[model samples]
Structure formats: C-alpha cells, structure tokens
Target: MAEKIKLACIIDDDPIFVFGTKKMMQYTGFCDTFLIFKNGKEALDHLSVILIEKKPIPDIIFLDINMPVMDGWQFLEEITKIDISETLKIFLVTSSETQEDRDKAKKFSAIKNYVVKPITLESLQELLPTI
Candidate 1:
C-alpha cells in the first residue's frame, strides 16, 4: 500500500467539491488529516499562522483556480515568497483545461501537477505513489 499523507489541504469556495473530495480521500485512505478553506485568503491567513507557529504544515494542497478572494494564482505568488517545507506538494485542481493555464502553472515550481475537476478514485490512487 502507498504511504498515507500526514496532512492535506483543500482551498476552494465550492462546498460540494470540497465534500466530494474529502469523501474520496477518506475512501482511498489518502491522508490522516485535512484542512479545508473556502477561499485563498482564508487559507493564506491560517497557513501563515501555522507556519509561523511551526505547526504541522500540509504535505499536499489541492488548490482551486477561481475563487472570490485571493485566487489560486495570487495565493501561489504570495505563498512562494514565504519559507515553506520542501516536501510540500501543490496540485492545481480546477475545471479549466486551457493551455494558457497549464502554461502558467509551469512557472511555479511548487506546483506538482494540474488536476481537472471531479477528480476520480483512480486519479487519487495514482497520486499516492507521487506523494
């Protein structure tokens, strides 16, 4: 079996997607803990405090591209400025499949991959080895 992730985060405004992704992760035994945020600003604020306090940072983050406050791109720009652990993996989980977005993601070294919306069990399973 693949090793379980110690912590995982999901930053998105959609409650349905968050709930579904959480269920999928639970079903796959993907992670031991989850930190959910409704928007990028919320995530940034909480994560900044966590980082400052030397708390357990998330091993992986599933970030959404579009949101009300502080979109994924902005979050990425800001988060990269702070000192973060090397093991941290970020996956851009969005419904957009545009080449422009894909190209833009390449600029951020922190981004491990781009995953389309409605992520399936198989896809989650595939991610286990990488983590």
Candidate 2:
C-alpha cells in the first residue's frame, strides 16, 4: 500500500473527465483526500484562501488547459504569485493534442509534467509513483 498523501486536486472544465478522474482516484487508492473544481478559476480562488489561512495545500493538482473564465495557464500564473511552497506538484492535464500546449506547459517551471487526456489507467499508473 502507498503512503497516505494529504490531498490531490483536479481542476478541469469537463464534467466527464472530472468524474472519471475522481472515480479512478478512489478505485486506485492513489489519494486520501481529493478535491474537484469545475474550472481553474474556482480552484485558484479556493486554493488561494487555503494558502492564506496556512492550510495544507494540495499534494498534487491536475490542471486542464481550456476553461471558460480562467484557463490552466492563467491559473498557474496566479499560483506563482501566491506564497505557497515550491514543492507542490502540479501537472498540466488536458485533452489538447497540440504540441504547442505541451511546450507552453513545460515553460512553466512550477508544472511537473504535461499529461494528455482522457487520462487512462496507464497514465495514472505511471503518474502515481511521481507524486
């Protein structure tokens, strides 16, 4: 069995993807605490509050590229502006197939990796070790 990590967070615009990821996390024992946000903006807003209150930030964040108000890219920028520790692992998780998106995500040093979606068993299996 894996160690009980504090929390894992999912910030995606698609409902189906969020549902799938949540079920997978529960099924896999990958995380003990899980948070789901509809878009990057909502996640950022809530996370920012947590940051200020000195609450335990998420252990990992699966961020999506496209969204209505604030996309993953914008959220990443906002996250940096906050004073959270540098050790948190953030992955750019999205369905965008473009190489440009991957390159852009890589440019942000805060992001640990870029993962394509609809994220599968193999992807999560591979990702589990890293977090």
The model with the greatest TM-score is 1
- RMSD in Å for all candidates: 1.2, 1.5
Clashing pairs in 1: none
TM-score of each: 0.94, 0.91
How much RMSD separates candidate 1 from the native structure? 1.2
lDDT of each: 0.88, 0.83
The parts of candidate 2 lying over 4 Å away from their true place are none
Instruction: Give per-residue CA lDDT, model 2, range 57-80, as digits (tens).
Output: 888889898988998889988888
Q: List, residue by residue over 80-114, the lDDT tens digit for candidate 1.
A: 87885555589999999999999999999989999
Residue 40's lDDT within candidate 1 is 92
